[model samples]
Target: MKNKLIKMLVGIGLVMGLAACGGGGEDTASGGTDSAHADAEKIYNQKCSSCHGDNLKGGMGPELTAVGANYSQDEIADIIQNGQGAMPAGLISGDDLDKVAEWLATKK
Candidate 1:
């Protein structure tokens, strides 16, 4: 009975983990993120293009995808707000930042 109970708990845990993955992260295509991203991209071109390149191909600043695959949207937003390594803070704000994060993640 003890062994059976442990297996049952493990099965439950696995199911819960899978369900957690079906998260509610906003989709850029249909949501307000689309327009927001447009706003953010314009901010990028104006404030960041000099260092990161017009398309974020990298110039004075590291490529936007420096570690793209490993980061999440929230993490990117925080980075944008706090600024990283060679980047400065407060260049973008609120909805614009969130949208940029979504666009950057899809780059590669």
Candidate 2:
């Protein structure tokens, strides 16, 4: 009886451990995409909205509604990092630069 109880507890622990580990992989994969978009939106609201408009409708900066149609991802990223005519350079950097560029590319 003692041996049987010990085996049962070990089995339960193994099953619980496996279940916990299995769920995290899937959640992390999906969560990355969600997190990137959320981060992008946050960054946009904080830095770009002042000039670009809250909805990309054009404020001090021009309307960005169809910016994706006009520029490629690399081009946009470059413009962001290097700055264009009246715009300043490097408003965002690192992973944020990539995320914001990707998110804006979907604006079309």
Candidate 3:
């Protein structure tokens, strides 16, 4: 009886371990896309929204709700970095720039 109980406990532990490992950490393993997107949206809201509008539908700047359909990620980054038309340059930079560019690229 003692041996049987021990074996059963071990089996249960093994099963639990396997289940834990199989979880795949989906929230942490999705190539950082989720967090990056959230960050990008936050940044846009804080910095870009004044000109781009709260919804990217254009305020002082042109409409960008579907900018991804018209521009690639690099192109968008370039525009943000260098400024285009009435928009000023360097609103965001470094990793924030990359994250925002990548997130915006998915808008299409």
Candidate 4:
């Protein structure tokens, strides 16, 4: 399985997801100014911009804004963990998945 290949990329055969990731903006949690969302955008710009676009308007990958319509944060997390369409799974799991979902949720 391709997942296996990805898993193999780990150092010393450890099992870890592909990206540095975590849950959504914590500023929303601590009653901050949604700085967490800002962090999410920054993360997206660095990791997802290549395919999804800087503004998330769409490019090689589907447009990220309003992705929550078809998928929830949890679902998106799954895609990040398992791969979909032309995307490779497990590349954006854990924190990174949460970050993307948090940013995408605010695309409205």
Candidate 5:
């Protein structure tokens, strides 16, 4: 009887752990803004800082400190994917593009 009770508790614990594993990062549902931004900023610094500046202050590229004021997340993603003006297309893509765009969209 004790063994059966332990097994049931272990199963319940496993299910709870799995249930807490997904979503909540993108929209701040988990309140992990710093972690999410750190990840996105890491990607940005790797792929975009050379042109956009370390703090989005602009370098060879225009300042993006307020880019969200002008562009929505989808718009920013389109720009990143398609290229705009002197910016080359596809400098970043896939999940990286989505993350960067989502982070930047909050800059406003």
Candidate 6:
């Protein structure tokens, strides 16, 4: 009986541990403004910063600091998805594309 009770407690603990491991009411994909921004920043650093510069200033790529002023969100999204000039195509896509575009639009 004691062994059964201990096993039952262990099972309950395991179930609770699994439940706690799962994100609680958090949108793991996009979350909120802060999370989206953090995601965007991470993506940019990984993929774009090499060419666009860490602060979005010009590097091998033209300065993106004023890109928001020059291009609409849709246009920026298109450029990122399709590429232009020396820039290659399909650098980023899906939800990341949208997040990066929206985040970049706020640069200006």
Report, for all candidates in order, the number of backbone clashes.
Answer: 0, 0, 0, 6, 0, 0
> Which lDDT values do the candidates have, in the order given?
0.62, 0.70, 0.70, 0.61, 0.74, 0.74
lDDT for position 48 in model 4? 66
Query: Which ten-residue region of model 6 has the weakest summed lDDT?
Result: 18-27
Q: Give candidate 6's TM-score.
A: 0.71
Candidate 1 regions with alpha-carbon error over 4 angstroms = 1-36, 65-67
Best-fitting candidate, scored by TM-score: 6
Tens digits of per-residue lDDT, candidate 6, 1-108, equal: 999677556644543354344322223565889898888877777667766788999666689997889898899999988988766666777887888898898888
Give the Cα error of residue 88 in candidate 4, in Å: 1.0
For candidate 1, the per-residue lDDT at 61 reads 61
Task: After superposing candidate 6 on the true structure, give the runs of residues whose Cα lies further than 4 Å from its correct spot.
Answer: 1-30
User: Residue 44: error of model 4 in Å?
Assistant: 0.5
* Candidate 5 Cα deviation (angstroms), residue 98: 0.7
Q: Which pairs clash inside model 4?
A: 21-95, 21-96, 22-95, 22-96, 81-90, 83-89
Question: Candidate 3, which ten residues in sequence have the lowest lDDT sum?
Answer: 19-28
The residue-level lDDT of candidate 6 at 20 comes to 42
Candidate 3 vs candidate 5, TM-score winner:
3
lDDT score, candidate 4, position 27: 40
Q: What is the C-alpha RMSD of each candidate to the true structure, in Å?
A: 17.1, 20.7, 21.1, 7.1, 17.9, 17.7
TM-score of 2: 0.69
Cα RMSD of predicted structure 1: 17.1
Q: Report residue 72 deviation for candidate 3 (angstroms).
A: 0.5
Predicted candidate 2 versus true structure: per-residue lDDT over 1-108, tens digit per residue: 999677556644543343344311111245577777777777777667666788889766679989988988788899988978666676676677788798888778
